[model samples]
Target: MESLIAALTLVVVGYIAGSVKIINEGNEGIVERLGQYRRSLKPGLNFVIPVFDTVLVETTREQVLDTDPQQAITRDNVPLTVDAVMYWKILDVQKAYYGVEDLESALTNLVVTALRGEIGQMDLRETVSGRNKINQALLHQLDEATESWGVKIMRVEVQEIAPSKTMLESLELERAAESKRKAAMSETESMVESIQRISRALQGQPNSQAVLQYLVAQKYVEANLKLSESDNSKIIFMDPKALTETIGELISTDQAELGNGNGNNL
Candidate 1:
């Protein structure tokens, strides 16, 4: 009789042991009875049915999920290796427990899908420069998609948006070409401004015909220097006879002096 009483007491103690639970702060627990969600347990002491209700899942703290670098393509077909970090937390423990299988994995795929989708809509340059905007947009989209999982996305950070080696080289080449083009444009503008000033200074010269001849001669000298050395460069050939005839019609003595020496080096 004593042995039987001891056995019964042990069974009773075990049952009571399974009936109560204690959840730590910043954490929550999900209770399930016979394979179905019964209730959620908040932090601290909680009571439940001895053997029927089981603590199915416990997760309440904020989670940080670092995404592996995902190979993605931009709208302009530039390939990128992108990675990100996500901040999230469980809002409904019961839903979190039953809503998805492999919660972290599902969330990860969700994040990657969202990331690729957003990146696909942008060019590679925009993805690199507008990282903050991308992060916020990702957070918003994630929050919406994760609601079914009873998860809230607090924030997202784009850790890196690395371009392919080819892309980097291409960008460098583009920058070089752009710089050279700007320099050429600046030189052209300066030349034009110089010509304008020379014309204005000669506006009231003794003979307008001589002044025009001198200006044309100056332009011929300037054009020769500005011509490109490249094999494919174009040259606008002008007839020397036509030019000389035009200058020969000038009768002013100043024009004669210009023809003799003043215009020779110009």
Candidate 2:
């Protein structure tokens, strides 16, 4: 009789020990009974039947996952590599355990597939410029799909987009050519403005010939002084026709002034 009592006590102790469950903070356990999902267990102490109940899965409070870069062709038929990361958490442990075989693998694959679809619908420029749009689209798609899986996608971020080396080089060359063309255009415009200013200045001056001759003489003298200071002293030469024209214009001015004086006296 004492032996039977001892055996029954031992069996009860074993069942109690096996039924006791302790879950840490930031984690949840999904319970299964007789090969069917029963209920989810929250953090801290809990209880379950030894042979009739089992923890099918345990889920964390939050999870971060980095996805590999996917090579995809854009709408413009340009191929690019895109990589991203995601933040997620299990809201329903029961669904998380039963809804998907491998949630992490499924989520990663889903993200890659959605990213490819998003990028494929955009041009290369749009894909590069519209990262926010792509992220939003991915979040929407992931949220919808993960609803059944009991995973909530907190955020999705594009880590990087790397174009091919050849494509990058071509884009850089195009930018450089555009900049060079703009610079050349600006210089030509400045030259045109300077020419126009000189033309207007010449037209405004009545003694334009004398003024120009004086400027030329001043430049010649400066050049001569510079040459004298150098080892190679050079004789500055003037065009004979230019000198003759300057002298003729000076004589014509004097004659006109004298004729005006004579007319006043008369």
Candidate 3:
């Protein structure tokens, strides 16, 4: 009799212990009684009926979901691939357990659907440049959708937006062509301004020969300096005094012509 009593007591103790659950920190347990949700067990030592009560769900403190790159068409009719990641946390254990059949699958589908919708409304350039705006939009949409499911969307981040290599090359070539066109325009404008200035200077000159001789002398001096500094330079012997006297004579003749015209007018 003593042996039978001891065995029965041990069985009872084992059953009770198995029914009692200890939820770890940063975790929650959902209890179901007779196939129906009874209550959620918070982190600590808790007890339930041995045979009728069961743990319906267990949820983590936090969760992360990385979405694969998805190909989408933009509003401007450009195709692009976008990858993203999401952070979520379970807020209500009961809702998490019963609100959706599979949380991960639901979340994945929701993310893809939201991304496609947002991308479809934006052009490729806008999608790439306005990534933060897109992320915020996705997070808001996801949070609203997952509210009933007890999953709170903490953040959504766009990881990457990849354009085709051919598109990238085409963009680069267009930019290069634009830069070349601008450079050519600038050079042409500078040449036109130089010609205008030279024409104005020649128009007012009373002695064209004297001005031309002066310019020639200046150029000759510059060339002589450069040639003297170079290796294997030729020695061109030009009389500097004769050059100055010729310039003086040309200036005097121009002054005489001007004086004669003034006297006739008077």
Candidate 4:
């Protein structure tokens, strides 16, 4: 009778130990009885049949997925490299487990495919300027697609968008060329405006011819100085006084023609 009592006590203790389960906070467990899902276990103390029930525990907390940099192309045919991060939470662990074979891998691939698709619809400039727009669009797309997966897409963030090295170099060169063209145009416009002002100031002056000669000589000297500063410049010898006289004669002829036209109009 003593041996039988001892055996019964040991069996009771073993059953109690196996049936009692303590689940920590922020986690959940699914109970499968006889190879079929029976119930879900919540946080804190829970009970399950030890020998027949199997529990799989997973976190309920939010998770982060960092997608690797993926190659993509913009609408303007610019090849670029891009990557993003996604924030998600599992709403239904059963769906998360049974809905997909490999949850993480499926999510990653989905993100990569969506990222490339979004980028392909925008130009490089648009992609760079509208990163926030891109993120929102991705979030919407992912939310809709992940509904059946029992996953909540909290937010999608584009980490980086970088053009290829060759594209970057080409953009730099194009920008530099544009700058030079603009500078040249501005310089030419300023010179033309200055010349018009000078012509107006000298129109009714007595020593207008002398003033014009002096201005022409000054400009000739400045041109020579600029040429001398250039390493590849070839020195060309010319008579400054002769060149100034020729330009002054040309100016006089133009003024005379303008005066005749005005008189005719009057």
TM-score for each predicted model, relative to the true structure: 0.67, 0.65, 0.69, 0.76
Predictions: Cα RMSD each = 7.5, 10.8, 11.5, 5.2
lDDT of 1 by residue, 9-30 (tens): 9998988887779988988888
lDDT of each: 0.81, 0.80, 0.81, 0.86
Error of 2 at 96 (Å): 1.7
* By TM-score: ranked, best first: 4, 3, 1, 2
Q: Report the Cα lDDT for candidate 1.
A: 0.81
Output the number of the TM-score-best candidate: 4
Q: Which candidate has the top score in lDDT?
A: 4
Between the candidate structures 2 and 3, which one is better when assessed by lDDT?
3
lDDT of model 2 at residue 12?
95
Which pairs clash in the backbone of model 2? none
Which one wins by TM-score: 1 or 3? 3
Per-residue error (Å), model 4, residue 54 = 1.2
**lDDT by residue for model 3 over 1-266, one digit each (tens)?**
99999999999999988878998888898888889888889888999888889875476667899999898888987777889899999998888888999999999999999998999999987998999999999999999999999889999998988776677788887897788568747754764454344434564577665565666577567656865885645658579888767556655555566668779999
Residue 207 displacement (Å), model 4? 17
